[model samples]
Target: MATTTHSAARSGGVRLHVQRFGTFLSNMVLPNIGAFIAWGLITALFIETGWITTIGKALGYTGGYGFVEDLGAWGSGSEGTGIVGPMITYLLPLLIGYTGGRMMYNDNLRGGVVGAIATMGAIAGASVPMFLGAMIMGPLGGWSMKKLDALWSHKIRPGFEMLVNNFSAGIWGGFLAVIGFVLAGPLVEAFSTLASKVVNTLVDNGLLPLTSIFIEPAKILFLNNAINQGILTPLGTTEAAQAGQSILFLLEANPGPGLGLLLAFALFGRGAAKASAPGAILIQFVGGIHEIYFPYVLAKPKLIAAVILGGMAGVATNVVFGSGLRSPASPGSIIAVWAASPPGALVGVTASVLVAAGVTFLVAAFLLKLDKSNDDGDLTAATAAMEANKGKKSSVAGTLVGSGAARGNGPIHSIVFACDAGMGSSAMGASVLRKKVHGAGFTDVTVVNKAISSLTDTYDLVVTHEDLTQRAEQRTGSARHVSVNNFMDSPRYDEIVELLQQTNGAAGANGAAAVDGAAVGIPGGRSSGGGDLLSRDSIVLDGRASGRDAAITEAGELLVAAGAVDGSYVPAMHERETSVSTYMGNLLAIPHGTNEAKPAIRRSAISFVRYPQGIDWNGKEVKFVIGVAGAGDDHLKLLGKIAEVFTDSAQVARLEAARTPADVQAVLGAMQPA
Candidate 1:
């Protein structure tokens, strides 16, 4: 028989090992380690006070106990614990949100708000539909601000935009929270139950020896009627309760298990382990929330296994020693447990904690040493090489254009355009350039109109009117720049057209030379009426028509042709209508895409329509109608850029009075790159 290679089997085994290790580290070790430390601090405090005995009596136990009997009474009765407990609980969520948000979005405070909103929304929108809705809306608030900033850089402060965006995001977050509370609570409980069952099975089968210890005690505590009635019952009551209960009942709780988990983390977790572990433990133990130590255990799985083993030992010790606390194991703190239970409960808690801490420390120390040796052998040199490569990649872009000699490569392609609102000139310029490149016609072409910030390094040649050049240059990093004069009549325009002709001519010549019998002549001669280009149905507005009249006519014609609208739309043009227009900052006009109607159009599409003679709009004669159609969320970038171009009052005046399609094109050509 041929010898069979077990490559697949070996790979599967390795993957299984990694997954198991990863799960232990992420789910058990990191989180619980912090919880353990917190528990330790709380337990130590409880040992000092005879609080456990009093707590037992308050819960209906009659035995001699010196501590507080009612868990609820302690807070209303004592101001110190009340303030500390609530404050910690509230701050923990915020801290988590802040940290996560900062990590993801580069420390933007608004991102923290968004993160908080997202977290809260996640909690509230527990139902499937509500969750989906919140997720969808959550990004909108942040995204809208981003869009506005992109559209109107420098004109508006980023901080103000973020504030507005976050405020809106908060409202949506609240809605999401409500949904989550209603839908998620039951689901979370169900999932927790399922998880508990799985954990129990692992313990029963000895598959998870370490975790079994921590979980088993809790399981038994939850099931025991004596512990539940004597401890949990009284603790669960509100301050207004009329309870005649035992005075010295035992709750059967141990703080050491939780504290030991934290010590385990400090021993093995990476970076600031010593510092973070204590803080993590304090929060988890007193707060009764186990999530605090999650990150630590997640940093190292083997360490978590050890911590879990320690927790099991601690819990087992408590159970065997009959050290049960009254008033439940809640608030996980030593003071709360001691004040609420019998003396034996305190002993049980102490013994369990010591055993757990001892086991975790020894196990974690051994693992850390082994891990250090492996890392030293495998990672030191590789890490240094990676750092070097990253540095080189970061500087590549700056190196490309450091010298003057590299700038002389004349732009490979030239583009020309026409638009209704000079406001959209920049957007149209960018869009056409992008489309042309997508068509594979010109890879290194320059796109220019009145707006220039739309230009990117991807372009080599730029041709635009004089007004937008300064702004354009700033964006393009002082790239080879040229200004157009008289629009089409300028020397730059002539040069560009000549370049196009030469390129086409050369291609034609090459094709002719390659084909032996092909005719070396133009296939379609210039037509009589300026050919099909001119004959393609022009909607001419009267030279004396109002801006609204012109806008409505243009919008109707374009929409009807595109099959997006029915019937004529009378444009809503009024006095000062185009004065402080959407073209305020950019050479743009925010004319209605079409008159408002039922069954709205899906997206905004611009229609380029020019007047042979100017019409007055907002005290200025308007010659163009750049129709703007928008719905759903705002496209602030597009609007802001349009406003920027209109900032040049002289350009608007020139555009309104321009004559002929070619002349209109030339005026557009004359507007500088923004």
Candidate 2:
């Protein structure tokens, strides 16, 4: 096993899982951002204490239209129920509940119906708007109906299928409605009471600024939407209804910290990070794409301190002046912040943004000046880290710095669009490329789409969305990887067609290069037939480690002793962990060194250690640490097999239960060509 195989590194709750959860929370709010904006505008313009009151008096319409009483129903004596009250109380919650249910049941209408029903009950039970309650019960109702149907779906009589489906959903929805109504009050009281108490205590004690310690780090972990949409927004809405505005909305959505960090980089950074800084600033400050700046902090972990201090400064400024926005600033853009500011609060909000940015800039500038690390500060690697954290390639990051280097200069005749799910965007992208290829008179070229996890090293080129490009490359490393921002309409489509034409012409002149699509940049095509790479000696039953770095060191040390990689490669493994986590979900983390350390590999090999107690890997729990060493650019097949194994929860359970080196080896054997 000396000349043979393994992998390691990556997490907060497994980055993908956290990101998906964040996405789920944001999805419930993002699609309805317009409705929110409208509501906010109406409240600001038509409230009895709002702008319309002053404008109407000046226009002498104070006596004419009852717009004051009818619309600005903020207790104008006549007392007409306004649009604002009903929209927040009923429309918004129902919309969120329905969307949540639709998503849970794979976007089925039935799920939406049940979800809305459940949400109505929760709304009735709670005194405030039931946004959080809708979030909870909507998915619960959908999941319950899904489980209920599975029980008797197959047993239903042929003619009564539709009848059963309708009545079942109704009956289950009503049942859930009652349950929601009963639980909503307790759930709200429990969460709101605790949260409100903490916030109130912080505000009263003048310690509200302290929240940045947790808020800043959590935002970097891609939990901004969950913390904002799921927690703060609901609480903020309640506060705003009671007292004109709430500071809770400003806590996470303020763009000042990110702005300061980017400005510092633009002024005093090195290499690609410095160059990308100016470009990132536009979106970070104006467009409010806060994600654009995360990679910068991740590249320089010390930068977190700057953002935290800046965040504290801003919160303090806002607190001192009682400055707050009328509505949530969805994008965290400066423009949005000002637009949503209460009548006379502009000066306070302005001071907050400026003070935060100034403090952050000063601190970050000092850090950058004192820095001696980062060999030219590789922003590409940092962006790669961001992509992993986000579970997709950031369009802004890719545009700033992302290009695929082809391993060959030969003709291209085969292309594949691969993704984890194997369908959706991959299928559509493949169809687009197929049309362009055939239209350009290169019908000899074939384009197909499939799941990246099962791909063979047979394609000449692979086209994938920037986020998916990394996983796609792991499967087909030899393929020319083209990363595009959009599938339906990408400039890369035309460029790819043009590339094929040029390569085809060159191959026609040099016949040898045209023999087969795989002839150029093909792998050694080695397939493990069980026990070729992993063995009993390489397996640790009850692995010991102090933490993530320690577990990685242990795995790498095992590979070193097995003669798979040079001792120097172990340090490189540590370096890899600093840039990106290797956690691949299902409690498995494959730690491997950087490409620069590839020369240290003796041959492909794997070292497996099962830490039953689980190690903390960048805030993610890791039960299995598998170290990998791929020789001669050979990783796809071995890594793909491991990915496939960990994907199945049942298989993961079996591996978790395995107590012996032999038992672990038996499971690894299942990954062979069988």
Candidate 3:
């Protein structure tokens, strides 16, 4: 990976902190998905749709059904709120409190119990459901109890531990419960009333469509997760409890924009993109993967206008019909939106989506027409010009230029596209990169998509949108991190390929220094210059190693071929594998002989093998195997230096991507032991 730096101005003030708090609240609810689904299903089937009433009538036992027939209230949405109503009213607060507490206390039950008990007070005597109240009291109770437990643990007698724990919890729970009822309840109710008024005002005035203006742009910027999950979902859940539906849920959950964009591409796009667009339509509408179409809009930046117009059309149609959803449409899939819509609102929702798609198609057609000629040209050159223009605007571009030199002599072997959930844009980004890499004839390279939370040091490069750059950097320490503004754009892919080529070229050259002025070349001492430790004949550019044992034997024979070790070294390597596999992560492994097999070493030497297909080292992937042969601490020192080199994911990436023995040797030769 090439060395490039990016800096984003961190927004400050109360608004930023409030957004962070909203993010924290959303994160707490995310882990308790089972609970939300239960609530949503119960509310959707029994209470809102009155499916229970229909079932009762079918069974010929109906009081609710009798009222429906007599009063002509078949779709009144009044099933007396049902069992699920109380569940949302009473049980939901406890669940939120318990989950929030568990989150605060590292998922312990102690905090959960306290949080659940404390939140009951907030719901006491409250006319409406106290979801927001629970959000506050639950975490607070858990945190307070945690602090109290820590204090008592230090002071309490060992024999009285159990007794003290129960009594302390009882006392704290009692006090917090009172505070929740007296102080938190009224405050939360007042805030809820205020928010309801604001929403109602918008709905009444027919100005609710204005929200799409901000929503569409934010969603394109990949703020969809934060906006939908963090802000709207929470608010929608509360509203759904009262109204039996919520337009807030439909705001960001509408997939019309993405669907429209893909429809246009499927009909009008050229080349592979045109072919892929047809498949994307099914994935977006039926499979509920709205992110499948993000790349299409990203290919031509002007298509964002189409997306915005489509989103607004959907929102306006939803508002005009007074259509709302029973729950948030997760994945923003059309099916999910339909399932969540109120009874009799499905027609309106479907029509809105179709209208939005049609409008987007017209707008996208115009945009594509404008760029049709340039679409087949060198996209990389255009991207390069765009990047150079950005550099000119940066305040630190001059300073960055000095540090923007190529890094380690490694090519990118593995690239991981990471996002918040890893399902949406990140997956598409990986697909885009995979196509580009294969087109470049780098078949050995692998590209995978993952959630930011699961990222590790094993990958050579991490590709993330600008919003996630900081988190990606923190997760993948030494791996090269690339930040792009849009995941769907082609230019970023071209830039990555160019960087890989530059690093590959630098690897073959001797005595080169990277951006940090770190010496990167063949590891030296007496090895390459005079000693038998390093030899050109000892390295295999592409080995036919099938498995762990085979890869080690192949590497050991390189030493045998060079006459640096005896036959005993082969079994020694096997014995070492038996005790503990030598697979060091980052797709590289060190197959060294056992410490007791020191006598088998004729002279300190190292042999390298690059497995293009990658060997299954035990259960781990092994792309590079460096067999060690040294006496005393010589091999240990060599192993340490090799660890230093391979640890830079960029270097390993280069080695894995290298096609020839000379290319592989150049990368290995550039390693400077730390």
Estimate TM-scores for all models: 0.30, 0.64, 0.53
lDDT of 3 by residue, 1-674 (tens): 12222222232233345445556686666666556666676565555245555566567873544433323221235433245656667876778878787667545567788888788888894666777788888898888887786553423432454578788878888788899899888888888888888988998998787788888765544456667766677678788777777888878778777787877776777755566667668777787766556545545777888988888888788787777787777766787777777655677888788877888888987777666653423322333333232221212111212223323235677888886544334544565565555455555567777778788767888898765676777566547888775443447788887776765442323222211111223344244323545566777877866667667778888888888778777766754554334554567776766555667777778788888887776677778888777643333334444544564668778877877666755665665432
Say which candidate scores most in TM-score.
2
For model 1, how many clashes? 74
Score residue 526 of candidate 2 by CA lDDT: 40
Query: How well is each residue in 1-674 modelled by candidate 2, as lDDT tens digits?
Result: 43332212233445556667878888887877777777777877877656667577767764654655578564324467688778777888888888888767655667788999998888888777788888888887776776675465434443455678899999989888888889975687477767778888999999999989989988998888878887788788767766777788889999999999999999888877787788889988999899999988888888999999999999999999998877788888998888777665778988999999999999999999998665244566777787667665465775456444533357887888875434223544565566556656676778777666668768889987665677676566556799875454578989997798677862233322222211112122242422235656778878767577668777888888877789888877765554345565568777777656778978777788998888787677889888877663233444444544565576688799997777765564464331
Worst 10 residues of 3 by lDDT: 391-400
What RMSD does each model have against the real structure?
A: 18.4, 16.8, 16.8
Error of 2 at 174 (Å): 1.5
Candidate 2 lDDT (Cα, 0 to 1): 0.74
Error of 1 at 548 (Å): 21
Candidate ranking (lDDT, best to worst): 2, 3, 1
Candidate 3 Cα RMSD after full superposition onto the native fold (Å): 16.8
Which regions in candidate 1 have their CA more than 4 angstroms from the true location? Answer: 1-304, 314-355, 366-670
- Which residue window of length 10 is worst by lDDT in model 2? 515-524
lDDT per residue, candidate 1, 1-674, as tens digits?
12244775675566445443333222211222243224223332343233454455558766632242232222335422432222122332333433344323323445446545554544443321121222222343233323332332222232343454455557644654454456543464354345445634653564533434444233222222223322223222111011211111222234554566567555654445554566666665665444344333434444556656666676556546645443334445665555544444556656665786677677776777576432221222322232222211111122211233433244355443322223333333433233323233333344433333234544445544454454455445424456542321235444554554454332232222222111111112122222211111332333323444345355445644544334332232211121113231122333543123323444333344555554444344445555543332122233332332344466566655655454433433343321
